[model samples]
Target chain A: MTDTDSTTTGPLGPDDITADSPFTLPGFFDALAEGRLVAARCTECDTQMLPPRPACYGCGSRAVTLSEQPRTGEVISYTSVNRPPSAFEHLAPITVAVVELDSSARLTGRVEASLEDVAIGDRVELRIDDPETVDIDPDFDLSYEEEWPAHVFELL
Target chain B: MSTAHLIAVGSSPLGKTDLPGRDLFSKALAEAFEELPDPADVVDGLYVGAQSERYENQIMQGTLMAEWAGLRNVPAERVEACAAAGALALKNAVRDVRAGVHDAVLACGVEKMTAGGTEGATNALGAAFERALEQRSGITAPATYALLARRYLHETDATERDLAKIAVKNHRNAADNPRAMFQQAVDIETAMDAPDVAPPLKLYDCAPVTDGAAAVVVANDEVAAELQRRSDAVRVAGIGSAANNLAVAERDLTFVEGANVAASTAYEDAGVDAADVDVAEVHDAFTVCEALLAEAAEFAPKGRGIETVEDPEDRSAGWTDVRINTSGGLKARGHPIGATGLLQAVEAYEQLTGRAGERQVADADTALLINEGGVADAHTVATVLTATDGGA
Candidate 1:
């Protein structure tokens, strides 16, 4: 598995890369690798942010740190783009969704796998894709665990 | 505050123009001023609305316009607020006159978007987005609207066909509007099948990047009455503005909260409801925006705006009772950012005064104009104009 193989599966090119390439946040990526999730907490505002920003969107203060998040959260909303922008032309019919982190912040990312299992308020977990071994970038290749613990949905 | 009436409104034909922003604005201002009985001596103050100084690398637009339009040395002020810059300038000018600070004022909005290349113009317009996040995410205005359109489709029963109707209707209306940038009418098939710029949104769904300006002279009752004695005058019944979070992620992506708030404030101030509005000129920067705005402004219920348009009564044709975007809106009229809000006002005045010609709604007595700036619903201005004089 190499970057080229990942490109065959995901959306990326030789020059296409993420802001975070060589450096990877383990706690963030490891959780996804283990089918869990994580986010960053602003020490000042106590606000949680996903796709983690270095600083707080609320307080604008740089006093922020990372935290492991629960695997399960409600899907606040979702949208399926039949046609993506030029940048994402290779990845059409992509489902972009916002999952409300239990602590308050919301995580926006692509929802891979089947659309039938996904619904607003459905519980989902982080699912990571190994891009280094493949041709795609891990950040763009990551997805969500569609099968939820029965209790997660039954509890609601 | 004393009442201020929009006595005169004017604009250069909107399109791809070789003229500079200042020159375009000056031409519109000249037309507006010349419409006044005593053009040379009437204006007591001038207000100019501009979204960015980076585009032209200049500031103090009102002073420049004042000088260029031959109304030199008048007190001039510039207002900036994403796309709603023009409406904000008008509000400030109206405030001055209503406060009796200035008997008469000229409010103008101008943007030379095409002067800069597409990328440069996009960068300038995208400045309204949350700098750190949007820049990192690389979400341009179209992308932001695309996200909304996706959400809208997900939550509602509306289809691509419904959104295409908005484009078709606006373009058809634009065909009759001499000032519209794209006067060519497009059918639903052309709009729906157009090439996609963003997912679920096509080229026809978006507004053009235009260089244009719109100007209006607002005056107090005394001045308005004097102007009325000589010519027809359109009165401003109410004005309202609202602000919201600048990031699309921060907002309820399903709704434009800022537009809702602005509409409530304007309707309340005007002592009327959405039903009273005979015609509307809304900020339809994108087709989905127009649909979402129709709901947000209380013209229709949530998730039912598509139904409203589909309803025979809600059609854009005459006798529809409530005509929305008769001037083609931003889609066909062009989105000259800074000038859009003031252009809405101009449209309202034209409709109320029965000067919209082929696109005029029959017996249009009250009109509503909505202008929004930024991707995150940052700023919204909603104004209600009535045929009746505000002075009385």
Candidate 2:
């Protein structure tokens, strides 16, 4: 229990719902901070939810289990945010993409590449970095999110 | 079950206005109730759609707007679904009247998007996207839709120019609409050359941050007959709403399945088909949305939605004859977030009643309105309105 556990075989019960469980945001980030990208694999519909959740949206089932996800994926679609939110204004003209991981769990993240350089179907690798080191405004984080890691992608 | 009728509709000036949110609501309310009786006399319930408390730092909009309209006590409440809020308000009102809960209900929406400048508006709207993964990645409204546009172009015969033409067509329609924010038409070349808010989504491709409000009155059959002439009222024949994935990454990039479900549900409820619609006001918040929604609403065949720019005769064989965004849509009419869905209803009301002068479609008896919030169809409300006399 000392190590952040990202894998769980489920049909989870109320006792299993705690901060240390990957089903909650705190536990999900805890595992991510330790370099384990976890997803809630819905037993009912096989839908993969990144940063695991308690319930499955695909088929409305609560029988979700955690599985560590592969870091590599391909870009399904991409864009550049010329004007981003105020918290990320310093990083304007940010290139972002929706990447489907090797496990087929899709997530959107900032890409460490120029807008002109990325294309659909391009291979990329997910990278987790400490939030403070990412140059994002500290005010962007809520009190609980201050220590959470930020994710980005680099073209392969 | 009682029939829900849209008896009257009104809107405030749609643009950068000095008026605050409540005052804007007053403007819209004044017009809606001008010919009819006082709000309290005509309606027994109220619903107000307001997108954010960030602008003007206000909440309890339902109470505030109801008070502004001179209604003291009633079952008034606020509703929110980002951009789809306005229509959600109308849907609630319709449901109440149809259920015999209220003889009449006032459905209105207002937003003071200009209260904060562009930066403030950006941050306020940023709350609409999925926070955990999408917003953390710095995805703005245009950027998320750009993902859909980028993939749509890759999968279909649509080009950047084809998308630009959507802006052109909507602008042309807007020029003819007296209520549009941008009443000046832009050619395809200008739209194509516009600055990129996000790649695949140029400045013209996006709807402006507008300050506006709209109000619609929904009444039962008996109430409608007492308040207005039969020809003046439009029947709220059907309404359907759906919430899709909050994250844009998880949705179908090319097709808006949720909108399709909502529209199909509405079409079924109305006992009509896509072909029966004579005019439509789909959420053209972005140029690409017009095309995507046309396909989603079943007005155009799959991947041929870009043909929305073409005249009905010139479009694909499977395309419906419905003219889209005749009130300039969100692209030109002005999108004031919470007020947009009601604005679509305003346009439909005007068209169904033959009040749309310059941009009026011939025999536009049946109308469809699709209002979407968040990226793509994360939330969608589709309503169908038919002329009371069936366009006799």
Q: Which parts of model 2 have CA positions greater than 4 angstroms off?
A: A1-11
Q: Quote the positional error of residue A93 for candidate 1 in Å.
A: 12
The regions of model 1 sitting more than 4 angstroms off are: A1-99, A107-156, B37-40, B307-320, B389-392
lDDT (CA) per prediction:
0.72, 0.91
lDDT of 1 by residue, B247-339 (tens): 676677878988899988989988999878888888889888888888887877787665434544644432234778888899998888889
TM-score, prediction 2:
0.98
Instruction: Give the Cα error of residue A69 in candidate 2, in Å.
Output: 0.5
Q: List the residue pairs that clash in candidate 2.
A: none
Docking class of 2: high
Q: Please give me the DockQ of candidate 1 compared with the native complex.
A: 0.08
